[model samples]
Structures are given as structure tokens and as C-alpha cells.
Target: MSAYVSVLPQKIPRQIAGSKSLASMLPTMLSTGVITLVATAVMRLLWLGFSNDFFGAWMEAWLTTWPIAFPVAYMLRPMLNHVSRSMSQPVVPIALPVRQGLMVSDIPHAAAEATRIAGLQVKSLSASRY
Candidate 1:
């Protein structure tokens, strides 16, 4: 009906507003929470071994850190965005002169040493290799 069509657009604006608000706020809330939880747990565990009262300590640490982390995250949003943008750049392959000096082994640090010996610059994360 004509009446329904006119009313629909008006209602749509309210839906759009709600969706935009949630879209912007949800990521920040989730990242802040996840970061807070992990940071608190790791720091607390290191500071006060896995004592029986870990739950209490974690809650206390989270309460203390939340106030600080929330503001810092908001303040650092621009800087973080820039850093994230830079990190997401496509990886470029660099051809390094292969040195046959170091032996390649299944052990973890051996490969790192081999790369170092070869003077190769590798990405922290290899895309297709992983």
C-alpha cells in the first residue's frame, strides 16, 4: 500500500542508525575485551603463579586495566590503524644469494640460523607456505 511504502523509509532510517552504531562499537568492545582478558591473564599468571584464587586476581586485574585500556585504545586508534594498514601490505619476494654453508634441518632454530647465514630477509609470516 502507499501508506506502507512512505512509513517504510522512515522506519528504515532507525534501522540504519542502529546498525551503524552497533557496527562501529562492537569491534572496539570485542577487541578491548579480548585484549584485556589475555593481558590480564598472562600478567597475573606471571606475577602470581597459578594460585587457587586466580579467578579473583584476574577479575581484579581486568577491572583495573579496563579503565586504562579503553581510553588508550580510543586514543591510539589512528596510530593503530596506520600500523595495521602497513602490516597488511602484500609480501614481496627477495632473492638472496644462497649460501651452502649452513645445513637445513627439521629443528626450528636451524632454519632461522640458515636464513641468517644466507643473509636472507624473510617475512615474519609466509603466506602460501603456511
Candidate 2:
């Protein structure tokens, strides 16, 4: 009987062997490649209709668009990420007047005041619902 032992590396490299900057760009490159390929194929199909030459046309369009898409996606990724992060954040509550015939901006304050007058602590809008 023969026994075989398999050994794994102590530490795996974070990236493949190549330029460090290229490694950082892998996500953007891959995403852009997929997006451009799908978009070009769809657009080509819509514009020219599916036919005998569809595959060739789609390939040409994808090849042309991918180069342009990659650079644009790489440059815009940071700004897009920032915008997405800001949009996903919870909105902060703002103070407004607590009075009758209040403006739209004062609805939350009026709601709070109504609850206060009713002897209920204003934990949140839902907390003070009638």
C-alpha cells in the first residue's frame, strides 16, 4: 500500500502574480467586461434584430465597447460608491415648529407636541401613534 500526503501553502497571496495596480483593478475590469458584453449584445439585438450575422455583430460591438467602458467604470467607481453610501445612510431628524396650522416641514414636531400633551413620552412617531 502507498500513502500520499498533500501540502498547502502557509499563506496565500492576496492577488495573482502581476502588477499590484492591476490586481486592485480586477473588480472594475471584470464588472465592466460583463456589463459591456451584456449591454452591447442587447443593443445590437435591438438595433439590428436577430439574424444569421447576429453573433458576429454582437462580438464586434462588445469588443469595441469594452475598452471604452472599462476606463469610464474605473474612474467613476469611487464617486458612484460615495453616492451610494450617502444614499444608504439613515436620515437625521430635524427640529421644526410645534403649533397649529403648521407647514409640511412642521408635521413631525406637531406630532411630537400632540403626544407630549397626551402625557406620552415621544420616543418616535410610531411610538406615539393614536
Candidate 3:
């Protein structure tokens, strides 16, 4: 059992060598690729409406750019997830004590309250200590 456990980590990489992480990305990658292509096509159509020669020249450039952009957008999923999750959770607001609708911004008030509570607690504990 000990020998088998020792060799487990070495076997994991070999198992992953033939597998496809890229396959999991295909649906998402293709969707974004299509959207980019459509937006490019729309711009080309608008340009063609004004000037056909310029649109034809730019079409080849847009097509070539997509191959690079598609892979990059696919790879960016993990980073996007991290950024979104980090931003989504809200910061806990600090509790501020209010006195007669006024914020009690004095440190002494907190210290006094804590001392009073601790004194009462200590008295109760001492009464019960056995």
C-alpha cells in the first residue's frame, strides 16, 4: 500500500498527456468565435455599403485575426472566473454604535462597555468556580 501510494503522483501526468482540456472549451470557444466573426461581418457589411474595395481588403485581415483571438478568449476563462468571484463577494461593513441617532465615535465608550461586561462576567464565573 505504501509503495503504490508513493508512485501515484508520477502516474497522474502520464494519464493527462493524451486527454483534452481543449475539448471542454470547444462549445464556449466556438460561441465567442462566432460572435466575433458576426460582429466583424457586420462592420464589413457597413464598410462595403460605403466602399466595396476597402471592405474586401479588410475581410482577409479580420479572418486571420480570429484564430489568435479565439484561443486567447478560450484561455482567459479561468482568469475571468477568478476576477468575477473576487469582485462579487461584498465587504463586511464595520458595526458602528449609535447613541440618540448620533454615531458614537469614541474609543473610550467601547473600552468602558467591554470592561463593564468583563467585570460582570468575572463575578459570575467566580461565583461558579469550583
Candidate 4:
């Protein structure tokens, strides 16, 4: 039992190696790559102005900037997840008085109210309008 227990810790590295941390970092790498690629290229071009060696300068800047961006972006992932979750949650509909009557901005409620005021059933709203 003790032998088996001792082997478990030793096996953890093998598992980690198998998963390839690089694979996990792929999304972060790709997203940050695109952002850094464009940013570095544009900034270098703008600062130095156009040159026959633009491609060389862009590649150099991109390589240097990405090392910094990758770690920063990876570290920010948790905060990003939190923000995205909060933003993505179904917004609680606030009940507010319609100050200007129903603008097209109002949704089903506006349609229902119009249908009701017109002496037509809600179902009639879905019916063909001739």
C-alpha cells in the first residue's frame, strides 16, 4: 500500500507531461498572438514609418511583444471569465413605466398592448395582417 502510494506522486509528472501544458495554452496563445501581431506590426510601422524592411521590423517586434503578452493574457483569464460570466448572465428585466408609450424598442409587451388596444386577441397579432 505504501509502495503504491509512493508511486502516485511520481506518476503525476507523466500525467502532466501527457496533457502538454502547451495544448492548454493554445487558445491564450492564438488570441494573444493575433492581438500582439497586429499591435506590434502597426506600432512599429507607425513609429518608424514605412520602409522596405517593414516585414523584418514587424516580425522582430511581434516576437518580442508576444512573450510579454502571452503571460499577461494567461494571468488575466480568470478575471476575463468572471467578467464574461457576469455580462452573459440573463439580464433581469427591469419594470419601468413606458414614458413615451410603446416605442418599437418595447418587445412582446408592446405588441400585446397594441393588440389589446385594437380589440384583437394576442393570437391575432400572430395572424396574417392582410
- At residue 65, candidate 3 shows an lDDT of 66
Candidate 3 per-residue lDDT over residues 1-130, each given as its tens digit: 4555554545334333444875576777788778777777777767665564766655675777678787887789789989999999987667954456525676767767888987854333565567
**Residues 1-130, model 4: lDDT tens digits:** 4555444545334433445777778889999999999998889889989898888999999999999999999999999999999999986558954375546767877777888899986433545665
Q: What lDDT does the true structure give each of the candidates?
A: 0.80, 0.87, 0.70, 0.83
Better of 1 and 4 by TM-score: 4
Cα lDDT for residue 18, model 2?
86
lDDT of 2: 0.87
Using alpha carbons, what is the TM-score of model 3?
0.47
lDDT of 2 by residue, 33-94 (tens): 99989998899999999999999999999999899989998899899999999999987557
TM-score of each: 0.46, 0.59, 0.47, 0.55
Query: Lowest lDDT 10-mer window, candidate 1?
Result: 7-16
In order of TM-score, best first, we have 2, 4, 3, 1
For model 1, state the Cα shift of residue 93 in Å: 17
Runs in model 3 deviating more than 4 A are 1-18, 50-62, 96-130
- In model 2, the runs with Cα more than 4 Å from the true position are 1-12, 96-130
For model 4, what is the C-alpha lDDT against the true structure?
Answer: 0.83
